[model samples]
Target: MAQDDKAARGPSVAEGAALVDLLLQMADDDLVLGHRHSEWLGVAPDIEEDVAFSSIAQDEVGHAALYYELASQLGAGDADRLAFDRPVGERRSAAFVELENGDWARTAMRHFLYDAFEEVRLDACTRSGWQPLQRAATKVRREEFYHRLHSRTQLHHLAKAGGEAFARLEHALADLWPYVASLFDLGPHAAELRATGVLPADAAALRSAWEAVVVPELSELGFGVPACGGTDATSAAHRGAHHPALAELLTTMRAVLDVDAAAASW
Candidate 1:
């Protein structure tokens, strides 16, 4: 039987909690990044692309909501509070999401890198030794597949279109690649998750898998994969110290949410 199959039939309370933590990390990353992405809802360079981008943004937030619901079931509190109420420092998202959306190239670059990593990570979760996580991953993977495809489409177009778009995409990739790998950091829950057999793979292992999945695609797109030289604590960036662009993005995203603290519905 698969590890998840065995986990499904047993009393694995510890593994369940570890899974909850993992879920929170996954949900939080998507929520914050989606919020940043949605800031471009109507301002995309072209209307058709805007609409398509909006749907991807919506899918990410929707994915976050689903993961939050699962986390709440395991006692993580309501999704909104978990999302909006937390200060920036408490957020577990990597620095990539916290950076400003520069141009379409930068936005697309970030999306392509993130979506590629998310796919590999979510695939691991789907086959997780923790049963609830396996089920959650299965549902999330369905939506994420489209996210990856959308990003890949944008990547192809940007690479094929020369001049400004190509330059922007290349610049964005070089700037963001280091932080992209940091997405799998998993923070303090690393050892506990592995001990419980919930995560099964460590950050290093997952990073290797993510690189294998993304590098070839990027190379084909004429973008170079980030090298191993920049791997150090100097590369350890976090969302706590956000770019000035992040503030602007946050203001736009929370415009409605900031209206009334007690607003009951979104």
Candidate 2:
């Protein structure tokens, strides 16, 4: 049987910290990117898209909250503290989530790319040896299908437009490949995570799989993706390293939570 086959089965002491780290990797990305997507709430180009992005934002934030709660159960910290109090350098989210969603092109393509990577990560998490994390990931995976469909549909529309829309999407897609490269990194606890069955794929394997899905799709849309290479391609950024934008983003996300001074409710 799997180590975490039973609902009450727990990670051993040797693997507990690794499990929490993995949870943070997943949770931090969701929380930060959720906030990023929320920035488009009232400002999206079209009203219909605005509502769709809003719903996605809510799902991502809710997923983050569940992971944080799971981490709390593991003695990491309370959900709010874990979300609001961590320094940018301490966060495990990728540079992709932290980058500015500058325009409709940037925003739409970024959303598509992120949704693609997230689909892979969440699928892996659903198979985790840790039951609670598995359950949380499995539950969240249902909501992600809609997000993927929405992003994929938008990309198809923009790419087929064959004029300014195609040009813009091509540019945005190229810009995103570097950041997405880091999405699957296993970080310091990589060995422990795989050894314990907490996660299944490594950074390289996951990136390759993501590319196999995305590159062809973008090419089919007439976007020419350059062969990915260098540090950006390899994704040296993970936990403990961060883009400056992350600090700015965290400041905005923490604004309200910092003011309340430990209140029980918002």
Candidate 3:
């Protein structure tokens, strides 16, 4: 088939599955991390942050909905079901998002790192040959711009606070760095996704893009940046085998539906 014709008809069955995998990876990460962010709604250190985190949580979940809708249109199933009803083993979320939100410093660090990762991922998606994904990514990237700004500003402030605040953030970065690789793991369909132009870049390219942004900023802030060896066992676990926290999180996320499984919609 000619290139334009192939693009017009969209991906083949195998490529569609790869696209679904990519979409789920994007959706699951946002949904899980958004839930984690929402946990701070009532208990954030201050009123301003309570509002900020709450808003960010909403944005993340909204982005997830966008991706899930796209995936559903491609025959993945109902968007709501895909978000809330999947078994833990079937989820494609990276471990970085599944970890509990630690202290304020840790949360801030994770927020900064994840936003950096998302920025790169969305940038790549904007160039995808799949028009739906390209448009969806462009839309999501607009909101994410502010998210990255907020997280970056918050990190700078925390880093400048010195003493205990500095120490806590440093420790958080060290602990979180290893899991950063998981965020870039594109799962089993990575090659197909890239070959078909569903994603313009592979996992390594995405990770490199993330590192280019994150490393320099952290170093400038005088924080010790940890080395990331990509695709380690820990990163591999995030591809299919998730941490126990994901199951607990899914339970909470599906609480309403769980009570009435026969309900038509959420």
Candidate 4:
């Protein structure tokens, strides 16, 4: 597509809504995952890594807020309420976001996997037909650039560490690879968004793009790619399946917010 053509046409209202829903899921996944990651704040294995990881976690939360703001403008509800008040099952986020921060290796694996996928996904959005979404995508793509850098740095270092770090990276990848598929499970919007050109690509194409990026990275790290099926794959790592640590993380993350009985400002 030509830049002038894209600039001239932009996105229609309905198309923008479709784009916002996609953005919301992206944002929600990052937000929840970041909150889980923050549990490692003071406990990170090293100070420099802790700082780097913290920035990624913060970026996720910031990205979530931007998506939530868009959703709220579209009448989805206020950002905080949409983020905090929804029941877990109502959340459109993939199960990967809810995984426990098992160890630095596991956390780093999550970062690597999610960031790798998000980069492609956002790039697709950056070229969206809708102006608002396209603009938002441009901004988000910039932020994710850093997220990818931070994650890859950790992934490479840990994989090369050749001790507990290596073991941790291996185990984390083994655990996270299954749920990685869920990131592209675009669901009912797949057709509608594609037809409207709201999404520049379809789920199958997105999945392929993700694999193209992710597989090579994993290979370089000496890890094998994990198999993925739809939600019916029936494994401990299946989509929609939440980790045991998720409940605990939610409890702590929401505790302060829950205390105010719904009317309090965050």
List per-candidate RMSD values in Å: 2.9, 2.1, 1.7, 3.2
**Which regions of candidate 1 are displaced past 4 Å?**
1-17, 229-231, 235-266
How should the candidates be ordered by lDDT, best one leading? 3, 2, 1, 4
Name the runs in model 2 displaced over 4 angstroms: 2-9, 229-236, 260-265
For all predicted structures, in order, the TM-scores are 0.86, 0.92, 0.95, 0.86
Q: Give per-residue CA lDDT, model 4, range 197-241, as digits (tens).
A: 667798778778877887887888788767643332535333345
Global lDDT of model 4? 0.74
Using lDDT, give the best candidate's number.
3
Tens digits of per-residue lDDT for model 2 on 37-82?
8999899998998897899999999999999899899889898889
lDDT (0-100) at residue 153 of candidate 4? 82
Winner on lDDT between 3 and 4 is 3
Candidate 2 — worst ten consecutive residues by lDDT sum?
229-238
Candidate 3 residue 229 Cα shift, in angstroms, is: 3.2
Task: Give Cα-based local distance difference scores for all models.
Answer: 0.76, 0.81, 0.88, 0.74
Considering TM-score, which of the candidate structures 2 and 3 is the better prediction for this target? Answer: 3
Model 4 residue 5 CA deviation (Å) reads: 11
Error of 2 at 62 (Å): 0.8
Off by over 4 Å in 3: 1-4, 233-237
Please list the residue runs of candidate 4 whose C-alpha ends up more than 4 Å from where it truly belongs after superposition. Answer: 1-17, 227-248, 262-266
